[model samples]
Target: MISSTPTTVTDRDFATEVLSANQPVLVYFWASWCGPCRLMSPILDKLAAEYGDHLKIVKMEVDPNPESVAVYQVEGVPAFRLFKAGEVVESSEGAISQQKLQSLIAPHLAAPN
Candidate 1:
């Protein structure tokens, strides 16, 4: 089974863990000091549990992962990018509600077996 917990990624392993993932990957760009990011984590954790079999949720701290931040154009905290087939298919910035976040990825998730 896929993990129910959100995985952490780094610039060094981003390509392998996210870009090359077999399923769609939701990449969350956040920082330690960002309150909004902290608020968003629980929502992500919930989604990770619900969608783990069909999707991969990953977190990348922007402060320590500058290469990924610059490459992905993440200029602010609480940015999200959904990668499918090795390319980004959806993206969002700033605070987002759980419903909106689900809608953003629902269309991309695999159907239940």
Candidate 2:
């Protein structure tokens, strides 16, 4: 069964986990200290569940994953980047509603089987 939980990603395995993923990936860049980041957790969880099979959702803690944070130029928590075929196809930052998050992924998700 596919897991809805967002896989924890770090600079160490970012390339393999996100960049090389078979499906499109939505990378959530968050920091523990950010209140907004905490608020986004459940919304992200929901998205992970709905799109788990068609899209990959991964979380990267900014503090420990400097390489990716820097590479992605994520200066704030709760930033999102959607990647397809090893390229960024869409991106957004800040705390956003579930509907907004869905819009970000909807374009990339494969039609349900």
Residue-pair clashes per prediction, in order, are 0, 0
TM-score (all chains, Cα) for each model: 0.97, 0.96
Clashing pairs in 1: none
For each candidate, the alpha-carbon lDDT, in order, equals 0.95, 0.90
Best lDDT goes to which candidate? 1
Q: Candidate 1 — which residues are off by over 4 angstroms?
A: none
For residues 41-79, write the lDDT of model 1, one tens digit per residue.
Answer: 999999999999899999999998999899889978899
User: Candidate 2, residues 10-106: lDDT per residue as tens digits?
Assistant: 9999999988988999999999899999999999898888888888899999998888998988988889999999999999999999999898889
